[model samples]
Target: MPYTPVNVSLTLTNQQYVALRTVNGTVVLPPGSSGRPDAGGLKGIIVVRQAGNSYLAFERNCPYRPFDACALVSVDRSGLFLRDSCCNSQFNLQGQVIGGPSPFPLRQYSTSLQGSQLNILN
Candidate 1:
């Protein structure tokens, strides 16, 4: 079964969001991330920064075989996709499966950007 993380409500300052400002830039936060149970009982969160201040956040565990924490996905060398080395699955910045065994896209979280704070909400 695929893991669905807990609800998330996070605020990021411009300075903090800078690191993830570029395309394919990623940040992983622990399960109890930003002081909340964001990852439910799974490993953590995998966030990929996209253009237009949009962001994509999903559980670190790969949907193809989430039971194995080692199946977590990482940004490919090209910085264009998230690749799960274990399963050789590749997901686009938007969490959609581009090349992989996963039948569904990565689970996503809602995000919004204000003057400077970027909020990741459930």
Candidate 2:
């Protein structure tokens, strides 16, 4: 059988959308940033970066146990991995856990860029 895809639309208020720039080819948005979809209490941030000639997007919530309040991740100047300052869990930019107690990778979101505008999909 052929696979079918699901379609969902999100509408955001002006206060929710914020413009950010990619530093050193990567930009990390915190949980309450603009690119994140605010639906169903889905809590996570989006990472927008330039990969070669394309842009990529990833969810900041660690996949091991997203509900864990401590699963939120942050990136540093190294442009390497996302670290959970609360519990010290570390995950690479690709969402792969590189250290700490995380057993899975971080969740990822689909992304599209048009005229410098990036759209992150949940």
Candidate 3:
């Protein structure tokens, strides 16, 4: 099956996501931000805190399950795993498949931080 793709360009202000700088943040699409399609960034994005000022963004959909609503992933307890509700698969904050029935890792997007806004694109 083929999945439809949309061009995504989302910007989250720094002050709005200050907590994300130290903690993991996960928002589902279709209802995130302004509740717009692009608000949560495509299927959604998981903003992870890294060393220094670095941050990472990844697609919320599990790669193995593709585009079903059941494929939507979330940040699990311990704030280090992204788990897919459908299959209970687990992925690391970096989109790496840690422990799951899935053979592939989660999809990742590109993120660039400006002075006050964090750009999540591609």
Candidate 4:
């Protein structure tokens, strides 16, 4: 089956917004980087690798529990992993709950790439 597409707008600083283009393919954006705090709420980042290629976008929120704050996924030299300082939940790059009480993965959104731009949707 084909994937459904969604549209989302993110408010980011000039620097953070500029960095979005650096990501070539599937990438995870951590808080204080691509994501920024807005009046509406915390906005997450969407990183697209290539046009017409695989695309991934997700919310910074954790799907486990409401009280369990600090659910943000980060990727570095060690790779992608979900870190929740409150509950100490750690997930793999695929958003699988490797450890902790999370029964489901992180909230993921549909993504599409157009030229050098990426569109993230619900």
- lDDT by residue (4-117, candidate 4, tens digit) is 233544432335455444434334444433333321113344353433345556565656563344554444344345455656667664456788776776666666655545
Spell out the clash pairs found in candidate 2. Answer: none
How much does candidate 1 score in TM-score? 0.73
Ranked candidates, highest lDDT first: 1, 3, 2, 4
Where does model 1 exceed 4 Å of error?
A: 2-11, 14-16, 33-41
Q: Go through the candidates in order and give the C-alpha RMSD of each one to the true structure.
A: 3.1, 6.6, 3.4, 6.8
Predicted candidate 3 versus true structure: per-residue lDDT over 1-122, tens digit per residue: 22334344444543545556554554434424455545554456677767656777776777775767687778886666789879888988778888878898866657776764666666
Candidate 1: tens digits of C-alpha lDDT, residues 2-78: 54446554455535445586776777767654465333325566777777677777766778877876777777877
Which model, 3 or 4, shows the larger lDDT? Answer: 3
Instruction: For each candidate, give its TM-score against the true structure.
Output: 0.73, 0.61, 0.75, 0.56
The candidate maximizing TM-score is 3
Which number leads on lDDT?
1
Lowest-lDDT window of 10 residues in candidate 3?
1-10
Q: Candidate 2 at 97: error in angstroms?
A: 1.5
Task: Single out the weakest 10-residue window by summed lDDT for candidate 1.
Answer: 32-41
